[model samples]
Target: MRLHLRLILTVLLAGFAALVAAGPAAAHVVPSTVLQLDVHEDDITVEMTLPTTDLVTASGIDVPVDGTVPAAAAEQLAAYVEEHFDVTIAAASDATSATGTWNVDVGDVATAEVEQWGTGAFDAVTATATLTPPAGADLRSFTLDYDAILHQVVTADVFVLLRSDSSTGEVEQTRSLGAITLDTVTGTVSPLTVDLAGGSARQGFTGMLLLGISHIAEGTDHQLFLLTLLLPAPLLAASLAGDRAGRSRHWREVAPTRRAVRRITTTTIAFTIGHSLTLALGALGLPVPQQPVEAAIAVSILIAAAHAVRPLFPGREPLIAALFGLVHGMAFSTTLSEMELSGTQLVLSLLGFNLGIELMQLVVVLLVLPPLIVLARTPAYRPLRTTAAVVTAVAAVGWLLDRVGVPTPLSTAADSLGSVSPWIAATLWIAAALVLLGTRGRRSGIRRVVSA
Candidate 1:
């Protein structure tokens, strides 16, 4: 009896130790299968990111020697997933009542790695499972009966992410409806009936607005180009404004506050108009060559940077801004036109998106302009301008090379520069304050010396 009791205790202790060790091993275990659902007007795009081992186990496919899934295995996997996955879409009025056989087609299958989870460390396969309902069927409100991985591995969970549902206001941002995991006791997988509520047009418009704001914020080259052009605004163009007496040209002392403000405002407005027109036209069936537009934007930055170092365009900053703004507009157009928007949706999205871009541009201008205006009067302004122009030129050259097919770290660093924007803003404010204080102290000292 004592020996039996000791054996039982030994077993329990071993199990307890194993459970304790599993706490760290949790990461190694597959978390859950993710199905990214992107909803469009006519159809729904389902992106499945499934673990390789789990897929092989679930589909019962033979692994090839090269560790890559063979054609036969891939087809088998797709067939198994399709058998377990389905979506039932109905008309807006009969969404709850209408129930008939719906056709769900699994599109091209592609193997993908979960790069973020771990690369060369973990394996995942991605496939596009599209469901195109009948012409009049509503995409916004539908029932999704997806039982992909959970069908086989009862404990396995499936995360359903609303990637880009125009009707539900899920664009670049994602909102989780819930997970599709089995009830361990009941051993049942339930349907994820997604009845996304709200106006598609409104959702699309707002989504595009937020996207535009994010796009402008991330496109460092665009902001850099604009800021560099504005660098020389406060300086007098002197002989470089038109014709010199054939003597060496130079930027004169800072211009009046009103003149500087006027120049900045004009430049900002020209850029807005330039980009807005192209953004609208591009969405309204304008064919924009993406590659050339990207390259041109980089070139625009380089040109602006050079202009700052030496008065290339002089007082014609707004003209240059407008011309390059056309290129930037084309770049911006790519963001909207890719959605394949049309009619009222297209028009509203275009308006809302441009409004967002303008709003952000204005905010950035307001944040950076005051410092530039304050510093222009200082003797250090010329050197400051030269340094900023040089840095911008370097970043532009990096981006130009990258867009033209040559990759470098400078572009990456420049792109990441946005992460430190808060620090930059803080530094600028502190510098402006110090400049004001120094100037006041100098004036007081001069008065005292004169009185003595």
Candidate 2:
């Protein structure tokens, strides 16, 4: 119990730390302005998220509170944004580098009610701006001269973050540059200087690797589907003498360790191959029907769960694993697609992310499967496997219904599985250890009795 509590607390603390570390400047109780920059070879694009109340207070544009801006006010808002925001090249350390201002274009003024993490719901205005440097100016390091809301609302803070930089191989990860706020003691706003470091292909690949690992770590549905299929891998399949379905089979005695290991290895590799093919295709702009793919993944889990109870495809677990892996890969592709990567960056991301997924998958199997193999030889195996399969099947059905546009309490409960998964893993480890110890003790007693 102490171990379980420690595991749960560790997970919760890590999550909290992540949220806090995301934006160091965003620590105020009230809403703050957020500015995200997308760096390219020749230019940078700025995405501005302005609190509606602060925008009106700063520019006096008469914006409405109902999350709408009038046509006249929208133009005024765009002009106001253009007037206050500017990007300039940073001076070199040697004092020999040229400096110039970039051309700024602000458009697509829109308003909506957005709920930011930890800040709840608030009315906000969002706009996109492009900053293009002069013919030979550096785009990596620059001075941001922005005072949209802070000019009037002295207490308002603005967080500057790097959203995507292809040259730096920073796709799918956000880096905080710095914050633009008034110096309380000096009571003055200074220009924000953003200096981004150089990056190589290796860095990009590593980033994708971490992304893939985290994706699978947090993706409970994907983990469940794969784990459930491996549940019956240690047992042999026997033909039921008078089965209704002619091809039906049931799980029987435990297979030799070597056979079980062989089956498990083949199934895992097959799954990897299956998903890798579709993940590449989907990342390369293949159209993936999101809802149907998600639903199909749930259906795959359902089939795997049923197989765990009664062997649906006795000797062909690898083939089934591969087939279902294709659906799971499509779901994985959605994450990369949202990153909006292209060319070399996209290719590298594909490699890194796939590697990450495989590494995490292997770790999970190593941690849980060996214990199950030991347990499979014991009398308690049948009941344990059935309970796991039934629970998994229920979660699958809940997810299936939810993905198809129906909501249920079962679906909500299934979502909580990820939070409790660490505890579950801990329990499995302890159980396996106890089982091994008990078996060893029994063997020792029998040997002593024979000697006496």
Candidate 3:
């Protein structure tokens, strides 16, 4: 009896030590599955990412040596995921009604190696699926019965994220819904009940407004294009001597303050109209070829810079600004097109985004134009304008070359110009102030000499 008791105690002590040793490893284990959901008008899109090693273990699908999912394995993986994943509602109409199951169509299986924290590097399988609720059923409040890998690998976890829901005012943002893990106490996996509340139109509009503000604020090329066009707003165009039919012209004198302000206003308004028209059409359904539009924008800036040095269109700056604004508008529409919003949300977003853009444009004009007008009155303005135009032309050429797939150091340096723009604006203001002070001192000295 004594020997038996000693043996039992020894075994119990060894088991406790093993449990203590395994605790750290279990704690350090990273989640193996991720589900990103995008809620649209009529359906939800699910992007599932799973570890390839665990996926093979759970679904018995073959993983190729090169880490790409083979044709046969891709089909098998899709079918296995379809079998394991489901979405349903607890009640169709009322609390006591029967549960309604959502239809899920899975496809687009792809494989790649991904890195995860605490798990090091591992091969991952990604698949896309569309989840559609039954006719007349609520999509926001549904039960997600997903068990792709966790159904077999009991220790695995699946993280669910709401990637974008236009109605909820979420665009290009990720929100964590919850995680799906086995309940150790019950020894079973439960469905995650997603209850997304109804979102207001105001919320969506505000989100789009902020998005538009940031878009303009961060878009250095766009800022350069607009500012470069406005560089000669205060200068007057005059015909060159010995030129027949008045074809050749140059920026020879400063315009009246009233005339300059009016010209700036007209050009800015024309640009707004041009971009707004294309932005609406493009967001509605028009296809915009992104590359050409971008390259054309760079070309617009180059033309503007050249015109700043020597009047190209002369008095027709508004028309030119409007024409180039059409190209810029198409670029702006790319942001909204990716959101996939529809109906009232789309309308509000359009208004909010345009308003945000105009607000920023107004702020920029207010900050930069006053100093430019003051500097334009000074004799030093000639060299200042020419130097600025030359630098702008160089940057525009760099962007044009880079956008066309020819990368160069000039493009990188041009991009860095946005970071130091504040300093440039300050210098312009200081120069204008000094020129004004010097002019006042000269006038005072002349008055004193005449009096003497």
- What is the TM-score of each predicted model, taking all chains together? 0.79, 0.81, 0.76
**Residue-by-residue lDDT tens digits, candidate 3, 50-113:** 8877888888878774556678888888889999888888443346344568888889888776
Q: Which candidate is the best by lDDT?
A: 2
Going through the candidates in the order shown, the clash numbers are 0, 0, 0
Q: Please give, for residues 1-452, the per-residue lDDT of candidate 2 as tens digits.
A: 23433443454345433432343234334688998888765678888889999999999888777755678888899999999998887865225255568899998888887755666678889988988987677777778889888889988999999988765556557778999998787877899988875777887788778878987788878888878977898899876788766576779778998998899899999999999999998988889999999999889989999999998888899998999899899999987775667888888889999999999999888977897788787766676677678777888898899999998666776766676667666766666677788889999999999999
Instruction: Give the runs in model 1 whose Cα sits over 4 Å from its true position.
Output: 1-32, 60-80, 89-97, 117-123, 134-138, 153-157, 182-187, 200-204, 238-249, 285-291, 444-452
Error of 3 at 281 (Å): 0.9
The segments of candidate 3 whose C-alpha lies over 4 angstroms from its true place after superposition are: 1-35, 47-74, 90-98, 108-127, 143-160, 175-195, 239-241, 245-249, 407-417, 441-452
Predict model 1's lDDT versus the native: 0.74
True lDDT of residue 144, candidate 3: 85
Root-mean-square deviation (CA) per prediction: 13.9, 5.8, 16.8
Cα-based lDDT for every prediction: 0.74, 0.81, 0.80
TM-score winner, 1 or 2: 2
